[model samples]
Target: MIKRALVILAPGFEEIEAVVPIDLLRRAKIEVVVAGILPGVITGSRKIRIIPDYDLGDVLEEHFDCIILPGGAEGAENLKKDIRIKELLERQILKGGWVAAICAAPGCLINFGLFLSNKFTCHPSIKAEIPLSRLEENSSVVVDGNLITGRAAGSAIEFSFEIIRQLVGEEAVKEVNRSFLSNLPMLGSIRKE
Candidate 1:
């Protein structure tokens, strides 16, 4: 059976956190549905605009193998404030599906009382907004039970790798990483000699 993943996009989402995972999951042959909280285009924190495949209302009743939430301060708040997202998350949890959140989005899980495991990681800046029982330290990504949480934008690649590893398998991760790692250039800029 084909694995289906749902990515929820709200206005001011973190583009890297959403796009990287969506791309990697597709490469792993997982069917991904990008759902926007609003109609038409959803804009990112960096002002990058994306047109979602469907509105959130369209997929509320659909069953997904995994549901992903990407973090930006405003985006996360928008998601957290919506009772519908909370209801959707509760349903996903009850069905034993994986719940993944990155950056500020993890805080949404905490606010909704959806943290099945104590260990989690989120954008450190969000630490002040919510009270955390325990946080997994020095990790770009934390996977406790069916819950997966990632740090900031810098960790998006590793975050997606871990997600693919979960939804697919280690072998698919190896195959994707082999190609991705080989193509990534060194961090520093070139010198015009």
Candidate 2:
């Protein structure tokens, strides 16, 4: 039922964190839409310019099956300040839609009061922002309920894989894993015991 995955980008977003998942999701034949926090171009922390497909002001809250947030200090801050974005996250979670954050952006999830008791991992520097007990150290990705998180940019690929698995299923994950030759040390690479 999830045909499209919507990614929200703001100024100062970590370019890798935002782009990797978009790329991976697109490769899986999933529709991706990059939504801007505002109505203009947003620059990543590394100075990568992203032209969003839709602006926040113009998007309907119900159009996306998933919403992803990529971390960069300013990007996280931008998402937090938008009440509509916050409301969308909450509504999406309640509707059983996938919601994800990577790196420092997960702090936005925490600040929105969405991270309590969720099993998640974030950049070590931002760990204190989340109130999760079952924290995994040096983890690439963690999924708790409808919320998924990745530690940092270094984990972006695996984080994206985790999202792919969640959206499309293990078969798709296996297919992608085969195509990418993903031998990286991440949760997705581990064979289930």
Candidate 3:
């Protein structure tokens, strides 16, 4: 039943972090809708332009089963600063929908007051920015309830795999990993609360 997911992209989004998960998820038969937070095309941190599949204003909140956020200083900041985006994230969680963010995107959760006691990780630069009591270093992807997060862009594969497992199952994740020739652990670290 993992049919559709929403990947919200903002300007200055990390190209790899934003695209890889979308591509991987789609390859795994998960429908991913790229939602542009801004009006028109969005430019990544590397200045790559991506036309979103839909604008945030155009989509209904109840249709998606999950929402994934990518990381880049400006991108994450933009998502965090918008009241509407924060409200959507909060609603997604309140409705028991899956939510995942990688690298600096987890800071958005902290800013929106959603990172409380959620074991997570972000880029090293923003490590100090998150409330220390909630995050753990050296972890690949930290899935605390519905909130799943990974450290840096380097962990995007693992992050995406974790999402695949949540959406599909361990067998599906393993098959995808094998198809991609990935030798990394089939599952990411499961941090004990």
Q: Write the per-residue lDDT of candidate 3 for residues 73-143, one digit (tens) a residue.
A: 99999988778778888788778889999988998988888857778788988998787777677787888
> What lDDT does the true structure give each of the candidates?
0.85, 0.82, 0.84
Q: Residue 98, candidate 1: how far off, in angstroms? A: 0.2
lDDT of each residue in 92-121, candidate 2, tens digit only: 877889888999988888788874677778
The model with the greater lDDT, 2 or 3, is 3
Candidate 1 weakest ten by summed lDDT: 184-193
lDDT of 1 at 9: 97
Worst 10 residues of 2 by lDDT: 184-193
Per-model TM values vs. the true structure: 0.91, 0.90, 0.94
User: Candidate 2 has what TM-score?
Assistant: 0.90
Which stretches in model 3 have alpha-carbon errors above 4 Å?
A: none
**lDDT value, residue 178 of candidate 1:** 71
Per-residue lDDT of model 1, residues 1-193, tens digit only = 8999999999999999999989988888889999999999999999999999999999999999999999999999999988999999999999999998999999899899986555788898887644555575466787877888888888788777777777888788778767677333222111112
- What's model 2's overall lDDT? 0.82
- Residue clash pairs of candidate 3: none
Instruction: Report the C-alpha displacement of residue 10, candidate 1, in angstroms.
Output: 0.5
